[model samples]
Target chain A: MRSVSKYFDGGDTVANYKLDMEIDDGEFVVFLGPSGCGKTTALRMIAGLEDPSDGEIYFDDDRVDGTPPADRNVAMVFQNYALYPHMTVRENIEYPLKVRGVPPEERDERVAQVAELLHIEDQLSSDPGEISGGQRQRTSLARAIVREPSVFLLDEPLSNLDAKLRLEMRSELKRIQNELGITTVYVTHNQEEAMSMGDKIVVLNDGTIRQVAEPQELYRRPRTTWVAKFIGSPPMNLFEGANNDGTVQLDGGNSLPTTAETSSPTVSLGVRPEDIALSTEPPDTDWTVPGTVKTVEPLGEYVLVNVEVGGSVVNVKVSHTDAGPGDPVHLTFDPEDAYLYDENGELVA
Target chain B: MSVESYLEDRLDRDVDGEKLTAILVFMLPGLTLFAIFSVGPMVYSAVGSFFTWNGFDIGQFAGFETWVATFQDDAIINWSNLRALEYPMGALPQNLIWMLVHVPLSTLLGLGLALLFADLRGRSVLRSMVFLAFTTPTVVIGLVLLFVYDPQAGIFNELLRALGLEGQVRNWVQEPQIAIYALIAGGVWVQTGFSMLLYSSALAGIDPALLESARVDGAGRFRRFKDIIWPLVKPVTAVVVIMSMIWVIRIFAIVYAAGGPSGGPGGVFSVLGLEVYQAAFSTPIEYSKAMVVALIELVIALPMAWYIASMD
Candidate 1:
């Protein structure tokens, strides 16, 4: 996709923008965002299910943006699987080859190949309703792969699966993508799933692209407050701050260094829970904010301490220990780890 | 502070829970009507069939005599046990003939019209126009068909005459074999309107995602409907078939109005509906035999409805 924009009724209001997303051969890039963020809309544009009001999409230099879904040579697994209820597993997987007019012998071979890959070979004769939920998900994936399409598009394929199945499918999907070497675009609102499965995750918000980077890069060095806040399980904490000289200052005497040249202006600061350190006495350096402990939420591996400081709350990840409610605490972040944000919620460069 | 008053405040004004009230209020009138009309009539027939009775006189206990006399009648009477193969075979060929014309032709034609009309802008008007035929009195349909099928004055025979095919024209309702077909055409005119409406509503519920899935899978239009559309619409098909069967079996005024209660010349084209009428009100009322006929109609309908309802 290169500068593709599809407007509902020709730009009467909201214009859905899907930018130039170059998927190199065999790259598994995921589109991650909340609902109505045009993530699925962008995927539909790639699959030729929707027409772009402007710009072009190319499959290996072939201008295929206007191609019909069947002609696009792309396979898609829907969130609901969208399997043909009346068709048996074999027939569902064999439909694309049947469409291509492949002879019977080769068609059966291809069906067997894909079904075996997804471990649904035993389910070939059964109807979709007869299979288990996980089996249906595998069948849907096998149906997509059987076509041997040039690329794959998965729209929240594992979202309907239970937690255990989702985790299992995440690894299974990565393995499949590695084996097939097809450029795939997977869209989901599940941050953990995207973090685990995506080679490069594109974070989108409100029909606009925010950040596109490798999973860890996007997580650790998010370009904006929105990206930081939206990309984690317990989301990165943001605190209102002011920029003065070479430091970003919060309430009390706490301050962090900023590379922003025009440092005289105030700015908001963001810090992840993992980056924030908590203690009883103030840290050796004077760069710390004081807060009263509000609550501690124990999440098996670690305890999340929610601390209220100057009308703003920051959650700190700590080991489960003697922490309790109604305790006064000192909170601090590494100066380099502290992120400064402009007034418009953009990362201060 | 005051626990006694707080407990009293929670004590109650709810006579019945909402779900119970809603169920009783929603279901009562329909159940009452069904009891009075459908269930009550069947109970009346079963009880009445056992009596050596005229309409006014419930005579001595006849026991199985009514059931026996029903079948052994010179003209075939109600044989509920013999109802199975009676479909394509049986002396009462009217029921079979009615189904033969009405089921396949009305269903296919109605579905075709519904598919075409769904995307049309003036669909509501077109749908209402067809339903206008269904809503018209059965006597009107029969009268209208009578003129069209009439040999001398009817427009259809006149058109045949204009085309120089004089021998092709006949008094449609009076002819023995053609009478069934002529009556069926009128029944079709009414029954088909209903099929169209059912099909239209069913076609509306076809999920649009199904089309996308098929398209992605590269299924041709015909293959899509064969694999996906057909199964999804199966329930709708069942509903339309049962409803049409009920209407076709219960129908009386149309065929009688078109071809008269005797159902054409020698009663060769007589149907179970016409048989029920003739047995009840003919010169010497075989009122018990008419009860047998009504019971036969019920027997024909119940199993089919049950079977269709059981389908997933």
Candidate 2:
């Protein structure tokens, strides 16, 4: 709810660092980054599972820096779905409430309501081992929901599911967030998951917030080159070069014209693979670069063409009918779509 | 589908043909010993209880008369001192001495040793020393205590002379009222090590998360032990209890080498196990009555053994 910074002494190499973030009410924010980015650590700090060496966390203006996990009123779903092994599905769902001393009558009523909501009423008497992975996931969801906690912490909850189940559960998770409307913080290394599921995504790297925005804004316009490179599949192609008046020059004798005002001697160039076009001859587009045909791979839907340009191999996803191995090719990428960065990997444009 | 043909086909084709025979071969030694020494004796005892016979002869049909004789004889009163009966000292009153010396004393001492050495850095050294007495030969154990309890020339009374406490150093083993307890002390010292090691391991196996959970649930230290630790250790406690019972009842060697029959002084301290020896193989062989006494012991112990097994 307010300024929270965590300084961790992660041994000699990265001796100290802080993770700072603020969450407003009812925000389905995601802490997104690659592994070892301390995104999970930050989320845990917010949930009161880990404490900050400095700074304060507030839940609607109440200092919660030292509150225990149970008293923090945040329910977490671990990546492995840490359901109680010794309990029935119903008992697993009812455990938090039972710990809080809720009466059996009210506990059962709330449990039944949640079981119905998750459609796990039939499996209530079954042990966790008897349920499918997805059903166990639902049981974990029901357990968190039955507590009616103020905050929901999801630590890569969908990462353990198979691809198909992950797809299905993503929609289910989004639906639940919409229905409950509790303030939630999700952590994941998957960019697409954060893009699709988050109302506001916090992109983190190396214990720092790289960028925080809605999905479309974060993708089309990233604040830093790390964000630009990390959030896209076959990530944004990046190279450090200098900007000429109408073109940019690479280390070897190759140059592409830039549309941005950068009179600096050094800069970084970034382009998404999807935006690059492969042509047998040069395409009559706003931007063109010479290249030698390297190779072509035919996936069922499209062809991935690799071209050696500016002493670096660049890939373009092309239509299958227009490409083959060892064909003469020129690569073209949109000039406006190019992102410029300073030497520090921060956006220059 | 003859059973032999099915078995032949399965052994010839479906099974890993060499594996079955190899496993049986590997198991032969232990299985044979178990059958001969452990299982065979149990089954033989149950079956042999139905007939009246000496150890080397053919038995006759008695149809529970042996069992009836076990209760009707005066030695039945001599076998165990039950609390319900208001009676004078049969050989029965001697076993009540076990309840006095071995019950809470050994249990508390074992628990105390386990707690004291539970966290020490050099705990294994202390444990090894305690366990040394347990591993010492029972004969040597009796001889050592016999030397310690000697009336005129013993090392203990001599130390008492050097310390000028000779009045306190009485003839401990020669006193009928106290010799049983003195011998029980030797067994207790040896046996408490086994229980302490067991309880220590039991304490370690308790889930650390359960302790944290109890703490978060507002459990204090005593409350945690009473409500959580006690129930989890109940099964282990049952095992220790049964082990004490068996060890106390079947104390053959300690009695044989320490005070023999008639308890070494007057006939003041003698329990059922030694009573059996005194009846069976002393000056006159009272073989028939000794067999009946052994039968009575089997009856008392069989129920306890069954309870221990079921608890597990």
Candidate 3:
């Protein structure tokens, strides 16, 4: 995609979308964002299901902006699977080949191959309504990949499944993409799924691409406060403070040393919950900020403690914590772990 | 604000008696009207079919005499007329022709219009214009068609004259060979709008993603409709066909209005429904015989009604 934009309602409602990106052949890229963020629109544009209001889309070396979807050699799995409810599983998988006028023997052979690959051979004769949701998903996958299209797209395909089934299909989808080696674009609001499945995650906000990088890079070095807050589970804790010399003065009347170089007087400092250490006893350094604990949530491996500092709550993840609500506590982080952002929400260092 | 808490403030006693009273209060009006209007007439006609009852006097028990007379009535079931290709066909076979011609043409035209208007700009306005005929009373539609098919003043002849096919123009309603077809065409026009509306709503209820997915799966426009859309809307087609079938079987007022109460135009436009009306209300009324014909129509319609009910 090169500078692609879309407008709805005769261009009256500008969607805030202008996309320019590339996906290498066989790369599994995930477009991650919240609802109404235009991630699905971008995917649809690539699949030729939607035409760009401006710019062009290229597949390999050919410009395909004017091509219809059937001739584009792209297949998409819709959010609901969108299986042909009237057809049997075999017929559904064989539809593309049947439409393209492939020979009976070849079509059967390909349908059987894709069905075995998706582990749905036993469901071949069953109607789509007769099968379970997970089986229907696999059948849709079979249908999409049976044509061996150069590009594949999926729009939140696992969102309708049970949590456990979603988790299982997550890895299954990744494995299928790797085996097929077709360039895939997956749209989802789930950051965890993006992190685990994407070769590179494209984080979007308000219809614009915020950052596109490896998941680990996005988590560690987010370019904007929005990305920083969006990528993490508990999210990064941010507080408004003033930067003076080589130290930052917290709004709660404490000062912490920072390594980030910034000339802005007013800045927002951030640190991930896991990067901050919580102590029941007050630390012996001025680098520590004292607060009262508001809530504690215990996971099997760690506890998320919400501490009130300067009338705002900051979450800290620790290996173990016995502090309850209203208990006084202190939080400390090394200067190297703190991130400095200018007032514009752009990363300053 | 919770349901249990809200209920706690109210007195709760006599659950069974109160529930029964509420159920009766809600069901009484609708059930009473249904029994009086629908079931009562059905039973009365059925019992009347077995007796010698006239409009004004009680007569002897007819037993199966009226039933035998229904099949023997040349106007009702003319076996020789069944082989005729021209005028003077039996009313029963004419009703069959109405089903064969009007039902499919109306439904398929409706489906075609639905597909054409599916993505067209200003579709709502176009749909309303097309549906205007259906919203009009059928008698009014018949009257309008009668004028439109008039020999001298009708625009149909003007259109034919303008197209330079002046020789094809004729008196469409008065001709014995063409009169029933003219009424059938009017029937199709009135019915297409109803089926079109039904088909439009059915098409709207389908998930658009299904079509989008098919487009991406290498299916072209015609192929997608043939495989996906047509199959999905088959239930709606069944409904339209069955309902239209019932309408064709009991067709009376439109034909009567266009051809007069005697089903004139040399009686070629007379149908079973018209024959029943003529038998009951014509001079020397055969009330029981009319009931017998009504019962035959009931027999044909009952299975379709039951089938529609079982679809749920």
Candidate 4:
């Protein structure tokens, strides 16, 4: 993909929707973003379903910007699973091969192979409307996979499944992509799914690429404040502060010492929930601030404590907390784990 | 609670007085009009089919004799030449022939045009142009057919002459052998637009994603239509067939206009509707036999009507 932008029917381009990225072959790249962020549009342009208003797309060394979708050799699984309602699962899976004039015997063999791979062997004879949503999704996957296309495009394919089924299919999809070694572009808004399944996650906001990095790198060092807040569950807590020499003073009167030097007078500080700890007494340590515990939520494996520091509230993830609401505590973190962003929300340190 | 009070509670539960009044107010007018205008004539015709009439008065009770006369009438059934399409031909077989030819031709042409115009750049203009024929009155269509199919000075013969096929040009609506086919061709022109509108709307309702998926699956345009568009629009085909069948069976205006009250040269263009009109208003006015032909048309149309009603 290269600076691919799309304009709809009335000639109005999607605001800020420009993409420029090179996805490695056999890589599972997830376009992660909120709705209307143009992730699906980008995938569609690559599939040749939608043409870019300005910019060229390449498959290997060939420019495919004007190619029809069929000649592009990209198979897409729609969010609704778009199975042919009139065809049986076997027939649906065999449709591509049939249309390509592949012999009937080979078509049947490929259909059976994909059906067994997707665990939909028993549903081959049933209509799509008669099957479960998970079965329908698997049938759609079988249809896309049976053809052995050069690239697999899935537009929120797992979104319509139930929560448990979605979780199950996430790993299954990743495993299949690993086995097939097909270059895949998956679009999704679910952050956790992107974290678990993608070889590299591309975070998008307001139709522009915010960052593209490995999931862990995206989590440990977000390139921007928007990505920092978007990539994690409960989100990264961001604070506005004034940078004075080597120390940053938060607007709420909390201060943290840092070694990075920046010319910006004001900055935004970010810290993940898990990176912060709660101490009952004011810890005599660097990067510690006094606060009062506001609320405590206990999950089986850990507890989430909301602590109020100055006029702002920050969530702290801990294993166990003896303190309840309204209790005084000190919030502490290593300065190295903390991120600093300048006035424009770009990460400076 | 007392027994009377319990009964009153059950009545109150079953029917709300205000809701009943509102239902009656909304439904009564349409129901009354339908009964008086539609059902009333049907019942009158059915009963009149069993009686003998002397112009304005009921003459005598002639039960099966009137039915026998209706069946033996040359205009209604033409018992002598049962299957022939000649002069003194039966209206029943002519109507059937019309339905068989006109319905399929119109439906196929309509579907083809709808698919052709579906994605064209200026599709709405083309669609309106095709659909314009449907809006033209059938009587006007008949007159236009007369002018177009004229053997001497018509555009059709002129084109045939220009193509050097002058040997094939003849009076299309005057010869009994080929006149029914000519009228049927005219019927197809008038009916295709309605079928096209039906199919176009159905085609619009399909999921575009399905087609996109097929396109990615390597299906070409024709394959996509055969595999996706046709199956999806099948129910609409059924509707168009039933509607066209009903229209051709009772068709009167076009045939009557082209052939006049006597059913044209050698009565080749006669249909059940024309038969009913001619029988009831001829010099002697055989109203009972007219009612019998009308009843037969109703019976033939009833199954289609029932099928359409049950579709919902």
Candidate 5:
């Protein structure tokens, strides 16, 4: 997709910004964004479900924007599965082949093979409504893969499943994509799923791309504060502050020295909770700030210590500690982990 | 007594008399209306079919002789030509043939129109224009169609003449062989709108993503309708077929108005409903024979209704 834009309500409302990206062949790229961020819209344009209001789309070297969805050779698994309720699982999987006039024998063979691959062989004769959600999802996937299309698009396919099944299907989807070697574009609002499954993750905000990078690269070096806050579970905490020379002053009256030099007078400081260390004793570092512990949250593997530094609350993740409310603690973070953003919300350093 | 103890005693009873009274109070009006309007007439008609009585007098009990007369009457049934099955040149046979032709033609045309107009701009306006015939009273439709099929001034013949096929023009409603077909065409025009609306609403209720999935599966428009839309709307199609069959079987007003009250020409377009009306209200008033025709229509319709109900 190159400079693709979409508008709704007769070109008055923009749905997608000028989105430019290249997905390589056989790459499992995930378009990650919140609702109304045009992730699904972008996927739909590629699948020829919706026309791009501006710009062009290409499949390999051929321009495909003008082609209808039937001739596009792209398979999409809708979020609802969209299996034909009247058909048996086998018939549903065989429909694409049947439409293309493939012979009955080949159709049967492909249906059987795909059903077995998805572990739904026993469910071949059952209607879609007769199966469980997980089985229905597998059936939908079978229908998509049976065609062996050039690109496979999935719009939040696992979102309807229960938590355990979603995790299980997430890996199953990745495995099938790897085995088929089909170019797959997955759209998801769950950052964790994107992080675990995508070869390249495109972060979108307000219908525009924020950053496109590998999962770790996006996490380590977010291009903007929005990407930083969106990509993590306990999102990076941002603080209003001013940066001068090599030191940045926290709004709560704590000044921290940065290794990276910056000249911006007004900046926002970001620190991931896990990167902050908490200790009962004063830390032997120039970056330590003193605060009174306000609350303690005990998650099984790690504990979150919320401390009141001056007036702002900063969360610190630590191994099991005998810290409680009203206890005084010292907070320390590596200067490299500190992120500086100018007033415009763009990363300065 | 204390409130809790009072409630416990109430709960221990097998029936709550006051609550039962309240429920019956709410249900009685609707049940009584249904009994009076639907069940009462059906029972009265069934009972009247067994008796020979006029509207004004208590008459003798006639057994199934009236039923036998339906098949024996020369004007109703003649069992000479079995190959064409026209031997029974009766109201019942004519109505059956009408059902065979009208139901499928109307429903298929309606389905086609629904598919054509579904996503088009000004769909509601176009649909309303097609459906205008349905809203018109059957009597008015019959009269309008009567003029359209008039031998000299009718638009159909004029169009045929303008197309240079002057030899094809004929008396549409007066010709015994083609009069029923002319009436049926008007019937289809009215009924097509009904089936179109039924199918259009059913199509609208379909999950759009399913259609999108079929498109991505490389199924073109015709294949999509066959593989997806047809099966998905089968229940609605069954409904349209059964309703149209009933309408065709009970068609009297249009046939009476378009073709004459006496079944067209030599009674070639006569139907069962018209026979019932003629037997009951024509000279001497053969009420028993009218009941017999009505009962036969009821018997045919009951099984068809049952079959459609059992489909899903």
Candidate 6:
């Protein structure tokens, strides 16, 4: 897609911005954002379900911007699965082939093969209404893959499943995509799913792409404060501070030396929850701030401690810490672990 | 109190004596009206079919002889040289032919119109214009069509002449051979809007995602209708079919208004409902025969209603 934009009602309601991106062939790219953030709009534009008001889309070397969805040879699994309730599973799987006038014998053979691969062979004769949600999702996938299209699109496909089922199907979908080797574009708001399943994640906010990078790189080096705050669980903790020369003054009267080369005075200091270290006594680190523990939540593997530092609460993830609420502690972090951003929320380093 | 007893007391509170009395009091008027007007009339008609009586006086009990005469009477049945089948033509056969023509034509045309107008601009306005024929009184429709089919001044003949087909013009309602077909055409014009409304409402209720999925699957418009939209709207189709069949079977008001309660020329457009009215209100008033004809109409309608109810 090259600078594609979409408007809903005669250019009054803009759905997407001038988004430009390239998805390499056979790569699993995840469009990640919150609700109403134009992730689904971008996916729908690529599927030819929504027309781009400007710019053009290309499939390989051919421009397919004005092509219809049927002519695009792309299959999309809707968020609801959208299975035909009246058709048996086999008929639903064979519908594409049947519509193209494929012979009955070949259609049946292909239906059987897809059904066996999806483990829905036993349910071939049953209606979609009679199947479980997971099985219905598999049937939807089977229908999409039966045509062997150039690209496969999924719109939050695993969102309707239970937690355990969603995790199981997450890997199953990846395996199927790898086996088929089709260029797949998945749209989801779940950051964890994007992190775990995507070969590359496109982080979007308000119809604009913030950053497009591999998951680990995106986590370690976010392009903006929005991507930094939106990417991680419990989120990155940002402190309003001012940078002066080679030292940044924290809001709580603490100053830390930074290697950032920018000369900006106003900066927001960002640190991940796990990057902050907590100690009962003052640590031997040059970048240490004192705070009183406000709350503590314990999970099986780790504990999250919220500390009140200069009227702002910062969460720190610790493993088996003896810290409790109202306990005085020193929060320390290495200067290299800090993300510096200017007043405009653009990353400086 | 113990927990089980306490729970039982809570459950029993739902249908206490006062509540039950209140429910009965609220239901009394509607139930009484239904029983008196609906159930009472049905039972009375069934009983009256077994007896020979006029509106004023009771006659001797006539068993199933009136029912048998409904089929065997020569006045009710006649022979037609119009078609291949040489069997006796009667009110029943006439009603069946009207059903065969009007029901399918009305339904298919209505469905086609609905599909055409569903997504078009000014759809509501167009639909209302189509449904104007249904809202008009059947008597008015019949009388209006009577002039439209008049031999001399009717627009139909004028158009036929303008088209240079002068030999095709005829008295549409007065010709015994083609009178029933003319009536069927009018019936279809009025009833098609009804079926269209039924199918349009059902089509609106369908999930649009289903259609989008079919489109993504590369199914064309006709294939989508046949495989997806048709099956999804089967219940409404059944409703439309059965209702149209019942209307065609008991059509009387239009025939009376157009042909003066005797059916058109040669009784070519006679139906069972007209037969019932003629038997009950004509000279000497054969009330038993009227009840027999009514019972036959009921028998035909009840099975279709049952079949429609059995569908999902």
C-alpha DockQ of every model: 0.42, 0.15, 0.71, 0.68, 0.71, 0.66
Candidate 2 lDDT over A1-349, as tens digits, reads: 3322223332212311555556766778998987888877777666665667766677776777787766777787777676655568897788777777899999999999999988889999998889999998898888888888788888898888889999999988898888988888899998889989998999877777789899988988887887887887667777657767767786545577776776677787787777887677767764666667677777877777777766787777766536566666766777777888876777767
Q: Which stretches of candidate 4 lie over 4 Å from their true place?
A: A1-12, B1-90, B116-186, B257-259, B265-268, B309-312
Interface RMSD of 1: 1.6
Worst 10 residues of 1 chain A by lDDT: A4-13
TM-scores of all predicted structures: 0.76, 0.72, 0.87, 0.83, 0.86, 0.87
lDDT at residue B98 of model 3 (Cα atoms): 82
- lDDT per residue for candidate 6 within B82-181, as digits (tens), equals 3444322567778888899999999999999999989999999999999999999999989988988888999888999999999989998888778888
Candidate 2 residue B167 Cα shift, in angstroms, is: 16
lDDT of each: 0.79, 0.72, 0.85, 0.87, 0.85, 0.85
lDDT of 2 by residue, B1-312 (tens): 974456566565655646666756888899999999977866666666576665545368677776566555444353333454422234445555564577556666776787678769999898888778778877688778888777778787888889999787877777655677777787788778777777777767776544443333334566556655666666677777777776676666665677766555444455677767876677555445566666656666788788877773
Instruction: Write down the DockQ of candidate 2.
Output: 0.15
RMSD of each: 9.7, 7.0, 7.1, 6.4, 6.4, 6.1
Predicted candidate 5 versus true structure: per-residue lDDT over B45-117, tens digit per residue: 7887777786746477787777788777644554452245642377877788889889999999999999999
Q: Candidate 4: give the clashing pairs.
A: none
Off by over 4 Å in 3: A1-13, A255-259, A280-287, A322-329, B1-84, B121-125, B287-292
Better candidate number, 2 or 3, judged by DockQ: 3
Worst 10 residues of 5 chain B by lDDT: B79-88
**Weakest 10 consecutive residues, lDDT, candidate 2 chain B?**
B80-89
- Tens digits of lDDT, candidate 3, A1-349: 2222222211212443666677877888899999988888788877888777777677766778768999988889999999988889999999999999999999999999999999999999999999999999999999999999887889999999999999999999999999978888899999989999999899987778899899898898888899988889889988789988788888988887777788889888888999999888988876788899999999878898999999999999999988899998889887677789987888987
Interface RMSD of each: 1.6, 5.2, 0.7, 0.7, 0.8, 0.8
Q: Write the per-residue lDDT of candidate 1 for residues A139-256, one digit (tens) a residue.
A: 9999899888788999999989999998998999999999988788899999998999999998888777899899999988889888989977678888787777887677655676
- After best superposition, candidate 2 residue A289: deviation in angstroms? 2.6
- Candidate 1 backbone collisions, by pair: A243-A266
